[model samples]
Target: MSHGSSPSHLRGLAEVAAASVLWGTGGLAVQLIREHEAMSPVTISAWRMAIAAVVLLVALLAVRRAGELVELARSRPRQLLVVGAGTAAYQGFYFVSVTQVGVAVSTVVSLGLAPVLLTVAEAVRDRRPPAAGRLVVLVAALAGLLMVSVAGHASSTGPAPVAGVLLAIASGTTYALTTAAGGSISKESSPLVLTSGMTLVGAVVLLPCTALVDGPHVTTDAAALAWLAYLGVLTMALAYVLLYSGLRVVAPSTAVTASLVEPVTAAVVAAVVLGESLGPVAVVGILLVLGAVAGLGRPAAAAGPVLPDPDPVRPPTAP
Candidate 1:
């Protein structure tokens, strides 16, 4: 679709914003999965992907978009694989982030700073100025997040496990790469087909990987099962679709930056659900993150180390 041209594109942008909010709630759901479901992080990621795949297939059938979905399956197989692999990498590494750095710290490091990286990636990929106004907002948000993390209460899960922190950074990097990849890919493929097809591929990749590391096991406990269901269906499957759709509407940088809200919400949810504490520093960090978001409006327009390409993808010629 043409950038910000059609009314439909504008509507897609709204969808993307809503999807960001939906993704923000994922950490809370995972927290619930931990307490109620008593599942390990590895198990959580595995089940979330697997279960979501099944549910989405059903949803796809019901929606009757199966024909377009089939075409997606036939087209862009390589790109789809890369996107799926990226998805798997993100899931594997993200859990590690929480494991090493503590959920709050890791969340900020990975999710918090992801927008900045994504903006850089988006800018370079598109060869565009990326709008300087957005960069200023992004910097402010980053500053706020840093302060929040510095003063923020650490999760008892411990200072992000050394391994976990590394994994989280790696995950963040891959996530940024995938955002660029997905954005570019979407210019060719339908968003729905792209989202579902990539997810299906992600599930395939995770199947063996999950087994090699974490075996299949079901908890008979009602709460545990319920939490698992929530993560799988709501967070993994549905949330991903929402995010992919949003990517089509929102610029890769804006989409990625707006998503910083997820980690902030995670911090708040951790406090309420995990009973984690955050002092004045926590507030400051949150503000920094917000500043980062606000800053995006500026730097994005400037010629920088990271901004969209001048001619990202050519629009189709009028008939």
Candidate 2:
């Protein structure tokens, strides 16, 4: 409040922006290895959370937290459990949905609709409404999502597979909660503490599901394993840290819009890794999504964060 925003705050915002871009690639990576491995979503998710957790735990011990793991461990076990259980459910549903549909479909549905969903979630919890900028961002993002839906439909058009579409929508709904709930956890705690505890919870819940449903045999392929590791280490574990740290300075809508990077990265990766074809229309759709996200980032007054209404039946959460 003194001489504009501090340099440190500005720097932190940038870091969060960068983290979001990296996160945007997650779906594409999932698509690449989805069929390559026979493991269930639970297995993939378990490995991801487990590997990321280990890396994060070590990082916190050696550098960030500096030997505070035990202290954190003792302090917030229940909250950790709650976060992990929520994460497990979220990932399991995500895996099933992505498997049922396609990567693009799932991501567009979940993320596009996330703003509106999260707005309501926050409103209910805080008993207050969203800011105008946040609402605008939601509308613009939803419009972009609608474009994505049309593109997906045009790609197929054989009755459109209603179930998969529905699943994709459900994925988006979970994402809304994922973000709102996830972000709320660390206001009074360290990001590493929050991430580690929540992820541990996820692993505990998912490990069993992986065992019961996915069974003993897991993917042995080194490439699949490597990708899963990357998801855990870079996307889930490290990414969250960067994103959270950045959010301390960056506005939430701006941070999320910057995350459009994940999809762009994922799309390019999908093209190269899975050999999945894309047409001009898909490219245009990607451009539109990126453009919209970019537009939302101008400035608070220029075209900042777009939010949503407080009412429960505000609108359909997907495009």
Best by TM-score: 1
Give the runs in model 1 whose Cα sits over 4 Å from its true position: 1-14, 122-131, 155-164, 214-216, 272-278, 287-319
TM-score of each: 0.79, 0.74
lDDT of 2 by residue, 163-194 (tens): 66676677666555555555444444567766
Give the poorly placed runs of model 2, Cα more than 4 Å off.
Answer: 1-17, 31-36, 64-67, 73-78, 101-105, 120-136, 148-170, 214-216, 250-257, 272-278, 296-319
Question: Which candidate has the highest lDDT of all?
Answer: 1
lDDT (Cα atoms) of all candidates against the true structure: 0.64, 0.59
lDDT of 1 by residue, 32-106 (tens): 666655556676676777787778777778988676667655666677789988987887788767656676566
lDDT of 2: 0.59
Query: What is candidate 1's local distance difference test score?
Result: 0.64
